[model samples]
Target: MVVGDASLEIDTVVIGAGPGGYVAAIRAAQLGQSVLIVDKSEWGGVCLNRGCIPSKALISAAHQYETVQNASSMGITMENVKVDYSKVQEFKRGVVSKLTGGVAGLLKGNKVQMFKGEAMFINETEVRVFNDQEAPRYKFKNCIIATGSRPIELKPFPYGGRILSSTEALELPEIPKSLIVIGGGYIGAELSQMFAKFGTKVTIIEGADMVLPGFDKDLTQLVSKNMKKHGFEIFTKAQAQSATQTDKDVTVKFTVDGKEQEVTGDYLLVTVGRRPNTDGELGLDMIGVKMTDRGLIEVDHQGRTSIPHIYAIGDIVPGLALAHKASYEAKVAAEAIAGLPSVVDYKCIPAVCFTDPECSSVGYSEAEAKEKGYNVKVGKFAYVGNGRALSLNAPEGFVKIVADAETGLVLGGQIVGIEASNLISEVALAIENALTLEDIALTIHAHPTLGELVMEAAEVALGHPIHAIVR
Candidate 1:
């Protein structure tokens, strides 16, 4: 330790104040541990500041713009409809700032000490925090690493000038007349659709057979269909080779179906994926914290590493790099550190994508259930058959549920339509609590609501659907 470097003793220390880190710090503090959290950047981390919140803010604006532009069907007409990209960026920034501020207040209210700095583990028991200059040496009884991740930059298309990462794409001073998005993952799809709705001629190049590859083909089809109607171009089975940029535009080269193709656009937004922040200055190796080959920390059920006292969560762990997943593990790790029986559970973790109609899923799908060796019964309810959907004039998606044929236990569910994100939670809860299709079907769902689609699908699974003619 450097001379004159004061030493502070802490019950728990959390690195990276993202959703996972801050939540763990707060939970540990609430559990009567003297918690201290160190973060390098803004309080809310990537999810709140750059990823989830800001993106959603822009998505909401795009939705509003679309709704207003297409209200002629509702006997509403408006002229001179236009989007101001600068104002949109301002709105997104405001949302990010407000939420980040709220997170700061929450940390303070929970009595968790906040340190704005970069932390590197000196060893299993000690960490040195630097904020331009080093802070006091912190000797912690236990530590949680939630450093999260950063966007990966392709070497062939390094982010600069006309090439943009998700972070840079979100902060574009003005919407480009044309944009090419590499990678058809949720981040790419969501931003592509957003820019399309904002009047950009958007093209998405996905290496997979379909965009949003993790989602079911049916869901991706619906999203792709909707995107196509907006004059968006999509290329599947495509490989991005390289990119060259000038002052005003970028030209991307790629190959598809044994043919080389090139596209020139005002900007190229690369949303390939994110890389974990476990390397470099994190110093997990020095502390004997084992990491997997992919650079993610190896942790057990309670988010504990090989080192009993140090734990990891979120993007640093081996599951989906989602904000909610991180927050969930954060609580579990904090509780486990406090001598509670809490352990990480991925059973009912829900994933929601804010596409045009939105997409959400929880637990296993029909294929997953079958792969797990369970005999399955599947029920699918289309939005076109639901009253609330028709009333909303958005009848273009479906709710599908999979259950055990013998036991009627709800195994998993998927949704593609309006409020899918909000609607998927009910099914997640049912699966988490081991509720069955009969339970969901028997429960009275209010009439003329989107949630009724879920109930209708459950009835179909039980072989007694009331709304639509059974197949």
Candidate 2:
């Protein structure tokens, strides 16, 4: 590699052009700062290229297949429906390519310099980016680190042939006959159900008492019920001991309630969790940026690190590993860099799981509100009460609103039903802007729609639900 002696000066340098880094670069450029962004891998990072987009595409295809197979209940019968896994992969790749190309175009349109290389800190305000052919140094007034995270590799189940991580699992060439999932978190559960829909017999081993451990049991139980209907075998509170693989199959040994048991599958997918990419040759420690023992960077409200000129956002920082959260922080960090008074508010960060019936939440739960010493009131409206839900043949969940009994201020919300991902945003916007139960209830939603569920739940909170009985 040819090393350049003189450093190229930039106003702001963003490392890791994932959702966070690219958005930061563009926002900084919009703020009139000369920006440069670099990524060692793909332009859209893991979320767009590997995790979110590809997985969703496959899930969509599987869903269509399942829908067609189950269309008898809707008075439509189909025969001989099949999945072409290769074509599904091609469609996924096409979506990824289009979005990544769009990101590149946006960067160019914003006049942000792009570099494809690995970057490490050389000094306080300088980093050296190295590719296969050249190594160049960059000096910057401010820098944002958004390197993101990777799947945690378990010692007992090292990734290889049949032992796969979420990244590798998404890229499988052919659908396996059977799959054993190690974790029952959102990632594991989503993929498990997706493949189950695709006619793969899936067995989920979860160490927790239930799948999707963070969510309230009512919501997860619905998902678990749907999974069981799709022929998923779940073993909760099971600890995986070891994994052994052959050329054609893999076997995982686990213990349920201290009794040894084993399961064999064509592939073993480990969706345990992800760890921040704060280690390695990044040289964060040498530059004096403070990070927690768990490999998370400590950042202020404006996303500034302990070092004033340096900032960190997204998975590398202390927050949920969410793409939108990273993008939100990216904007605040960029605005702060431009001497604008911008800060992050974690009060209304919504989380969604794209499962069979979909689950989403924002702000707090009823138990959380009561735990925080607020006199809480919960209003819940069942999906069965909605005409649109019955029309769509998906009415197995509910919309719940939690609020202060005294103030009627909306504290939080949880939705579990069809289109929950899209519906949760209304509650999120309400919470973010301090809207109350009355505000949501008074807002006229279209008749016979899923969004009316939110209004009905709010009206339930007000003790006079129009669509459902008060009892």
Candidate 3:
């Protein structure tokens, strides 16, 4: 570590070593730009350390537990079905450690300097990196700010003790007997279901009319059904009034349907949304970086900020707070700094929810396509008709494809079922390359496989679906 006030010169400096920052650093190094990456927290940031990785790990464990217990429908019976949460937590930590370690290895392989400290901007071309032990300064020709966001905390339910955030929710040493979740979005729904599968009674309070307000209601309906099956109590169009916590449990007050109600639980988790990490002592305002009232930095098509040489991406920029989206923008920003003509294309960004039924969407939805002035034709296919779905004993969802009525262009697609996260990528690629419904239909898809669902949906759009009747 460099001590004292000597300023080390670098070609590019990346702030916040999350998915976005590390990727930007590696790409910049690959482009022959000497790069230095710094973060105050973990190397892989929240996604790998506390957010995506750990949550998904627990989700996977919970799913395994559910699958084993519910296998009687498949004529498979097992006794003594149980989940040791301590072992599950150990597995989650192993996954996170492996991934974060990979990030460190990748940075080292790329020859990028890594620093552990908070980075504060001194000017457009300079920043001071410091920790408890020492403070060092760096002068850079270019910089990429990939600082991510944190879970938004409601004032009425400050995170502490029994009041928990997603970070704390994931780190619970043992599963709580009951949990009260304040948001029903992806985070809330995912965590609620994970804990519910672990035998926790979960109650969700959502201000929106439905959970996952961003997704189409039909797609979310299956998820809500599964949540109910797991004994979850959902209160929609509700507001969290306040919360009081005792040493043993927390009680939350809220209102729904013009009636005030209260629920008590071992923990109260608030996951309404996430606020960008663009404020505080980082000194964006001091360096003339223009930001919105919401603290999002305004960026150009290539992720360049108000200052030509300075760039911002990921949660700090104006877009969905997804780690993959940040990675996509990271490459573009790095290439732009390397004098490449790379620009970000958001047309094919896919979003997925790791819920029980696994909902995913890419490009435009049916309503979104129509709102964009496209005459849309939609094709729907149910999983019950698929042999693989039936054989797997998981036939509780469908695939819907939206296309242009006039030109047969594939506009968008939504999937709610098994491996929807993996299935949406093909649709995303189709939308990204401007492929038509005929293109997908013409491709030979193997029989009895989930991929056929996409092909059959395309066939339905073309007015001749072999597997299902066209009404």
Measured with C-alpha atoms, the lDDT of residue 163 in candidate 3 is 93
Q: Stretches of candidate 2 above 4 Å error?
A: 1-4
Whole-structure CA lDDT of model 3: 0.94
Write model 2 residue lDDT over 145-219, tens digit each, in one string.
Answer: 999999999999999999999999999999988999999999999998998888899999999999999998999
Ten-residue stretch with the least lDDT total in model 1: 1-10
Cα lDDT of model 1 by residue, 1-471, tens digit: 346866789999999899999999999999999999999899989999889999999999999999999899888999999888888889999999899999999999999988898898887899988787656689999999999999998899888899999999888888789999999999999999999998899888889999999999998899999999999889999999999899989999999998999999999999999999999887887877888898999999999999999999999889899999999999999999999999887999999999988999999999999999999999899999998898888999999999999999999999999999999999998998999998998888898799999999998888898887786
lDDT by residue for model 3 over 288-307, one digit each (tens)? 99999999999999999999
| Ten residues in sequence with the least summed lDDT for candidate 3 | 1-10
lDDT assessment of candidate 1:
0.92
For model 2 the TM-score comes to 0.99
Ten-residue region with minimum lDDT total, candidate 2: 1-10
